[model samples]
Target: MAFTVSANFAISADGKISSDPQRPSGWTSSQDHKRLLELRRNADAIIVGRGTLCADNMSLTVPDQTPQPLRCVVSRKGNFNGNEKIFHSHGGDIHLLVTNAISCDFERDSVTLHFANLTDFIETLHRDHGVKHIHCEGGGMLLRALLDYDLLDTLHLTWAAHTLFGGTNAPTISGLDDGIFFSSRHFSLVEMIESGAEGELFLTYQRNDAAK
Candidate 1:
């Protein structure tokens, strides 16, 4: 069985993913947020990096919905607070994927912490958990790791016209690469969505079957 991995992110026209360290305000437009929620609603499981979870303090739950999809967080250090809104609330199932070096003594039926390599973690999510569709909402580090591993099958990107917070430390959706050669095939444009007053381009790309 083949599992599909799709990445979704909003970046400025200048290709900056986030403007601030604490909050990502103005990076993603209001219309993009609505579309993201709809994508979340359609996904079987939504995956995020630990940095994004801690920075945003997200609960990762859909409001007024029952039997929500599992919330998965990929963390090598497993340093997140258990008392955070995501773990404390009993809305949906929560799964934490951590390296074997991390240890946790927390006990809760609603939450399950698993230790495995990142590649094994992805395989388990697909083969054991019955996850057909995986959506990645990321911090740049995570995106880089996935792309490096060639785990991404598709990408959904929204480019906004606003530009904010640029420096050596700020991260972009596509991280540092030494111009490594990789084959690229043409992908059809899905939609050119405008976010309210400002026009933001929503683009989707699918990997070529022959390339894989």
Candidate 2:
């Protein structure tokens, strides 16, 4: 049996997942941030792509008042600063999963680095790290891989009202083949509603076992 995975992210009403490279505000509403932080508090671990880590310089830590979830990054190239905020001593537990060929010496108060096969990474996370629920805060390619591998069991999407960069480089929730499976067979909508924050809509979907 494959371990279960969940993905959560914000998008625009126009289906744009990200804004222009020069600006990223308004892509996620304040209420969306609150809800996402709540999900982070409930999750066992939070997974993100290297690009997110590098681009945002994110510490992956919740506010001081909230309980923090373990941070995990997926990177094949192992291209990240060891002393970044996410890997800092004050940050909560952190883990990095990289390809076997990449090498790095990361030493922090509670940092662990694992080099493993991409196919088995999720299994290892569940078996060895006690990660029962994973919240993937993605960067497109990583989400695509998880969807392609059928590793994601649930999706929580918050659609913001504003539009962003509509060019070829922006990330969207539904990929080329994604809509076909999601619409006809592999997945089913579990919930959808216009949340109270601004004009955001919260959508949730789950996989259909019969289609697997």
Candidate 3:
């Protein structure tokens, strides 16, 4: 509960993470990709929803770094694809948090599965694994859940203005188009950098303690 959680995302000018819901977010510049790796390097663990993991074919490994961050994947029923790139990649321990009672028998030496709610799983990561900082690379709904739980501590965003994903159903940063509402979570901008050449903007925000 005391650990820090930071979420990273790259959104188009229209506030969409991807042109298509299932498409990988590879539209950002190489500079943004480097920034993503840098963020991963600083985390004790990396978390992603099953959807994002599959969509992007993410390996969740920090390149050339010893003792990579723990790779964590969460799903409602633990229906993860064992064939996904993350499973075969070299990285720290893999933790699968299943929120439902549905059994996940993903057998592997590096993989450890847990059936628990998100809050409890996070607490276990902190209390048992000594995870002090968690970096989340998301596909929207997962980020929304973290916000609803008041667990997000920091936000890193790359605003890619060059691409446009114009559609009424396009998902925003929170993917909250279902009319379900949560209280406003306030964050203060801590850093901002303009990359005019790349047509992108990098921003970092810290959750406002007063709001909590």
Best by TM-score: 3
| Residue pairs with backbone atoms closer than 3 Å in model 2 (clashes) | none
Q: On residues 74-171, what C-alpha lDDT tens digit does candidate 3 reach at each position?
A: 98988765799998888889999999865866677778899899989999999999999999999787888888788899999998988888786666
lDDT, candidate 2, at 155: 85
Per-model TM-score versus the true fold: 0.85, 0.82, 0.94
Q: What is the C-alpha local distance difference test score of each model?
A: 0.72, 0.70, 0.86
Residue 41, model 1: lDDT of 79
Off by over 4 Å in 1: 20-22, 25-27, 100-102, 105-107, 175-188, 209-212
Which portions of model 3 show Cα errors greater than 4 Å?
210-212
In model 1, pairs of residues that clash are none
Top lDDT model: 3
RMSD of 1: 2.8
Model 3 C-alpha lDDT versus the unseen true structure: 0.86
Task: Give the winner by lDDT: 1 or 2.
Answer: 1
